[model samples]
Target: MQHLEEQIAHLTRTVEELNSVVTNQQSEIDRLTRRVEMLLQREAERAQEGSGGVVFGDERPPHY
Candidate 1:
């Protein structure tokens, strides 16, 4: 009876510790996910600002 109670207490503490670890990991993951999303959004906007690759035939090239 006492031994069982001790085991339960130990297991409870372990579960609480694991829950804390999981919570911290989830917070970190959320931060990273937001950062990645912001980076991708910036990249998308940058892509949108680029030229469409075609230029007029009369335009001077870079070698000029």
Candidate 2:
């Protein structure tokens, strides 16, 4: 009976440790996702700016 109780305690401790590790990994994933979204927004802005520059793609006025 004592041996059985000891085994149960050890298993419970192992499961608790694994749960903490999974929780930490989820938080890290959320942080990285936000960073990627910010980078994508900045890239889109840069592309739009390039398409509207002088002597590039935008149209010029009359009297040239």
Candidate 3:
């Protein structure tokens, strides 16, 4: 029936729209994941070089 066809079409469109949104979100997640990985690697290297001067708990900073 025409009504059934219309409902199917509407549902299909909605599904497509949701799929596109999910794809975009996945791409953004992937990009952010890569950035986080790069930052972690950079921080690890900085730690190895002992240049970050990261303060630990209950420890005062060098300027303090």
Candidate 4:
């Protein structure tokens, strides 16, 4: 029936829109994941070189 066809069309359009949104979000998530991995690698290298700005819990601030 015509009504059923219209409903299918609307549902198809909505699904397409949602799929596009999900695809874009996945791309953004992938980019952010890569950035985090890079940062972690850099931090690890800095720690190995003993040049990282890591502080211990018992250490006081310079102004203390």
lDDT of each: 0.90, 0.87, 0.95, 0.96
RMSD (Cα, Å) of model 1:
6.9
What digit string (tens of lDDT, one per residue) describes model 4 on residues 3-59?
Answer: 999999999999999999999999999999999999999999999998987679999
Query: In candidate 1, what are the lDDT values of residues 9-46, reduced to their tens digit?
Result: 99999999999999999999999999999999887877
lDDT of 2 by residue, 1-64 (tens): 9999999999999999999999999999999999999999988887788853346356665456
List TM-score per model, in order: 0.78, 0.71, 0.83, 0.82
Best by TM-score: 3
Where is model 2 more than 4 Å wrong at Cα?
A: 51-64
Please provide, for model 3 over 5-51, each residue's C-alpha lDDT reduced to its tens digit, 9 standing for 90 to 100. 99999999999999999999999999999999999999999989999
Model 3: per-residue Cα lDDT at residue 13: 100
Off by over 4 Å in 4: 54-64
Q: After superposition, how far is residue 30 of candidate 1 from its true place, in Å?
A: 0.5
Error of 4 at 63 (Å): 14
Which runs of model 3 end up more than 4 angstroms from their true locations? Answer: 54-64
lDDT of 2 at 31: 97
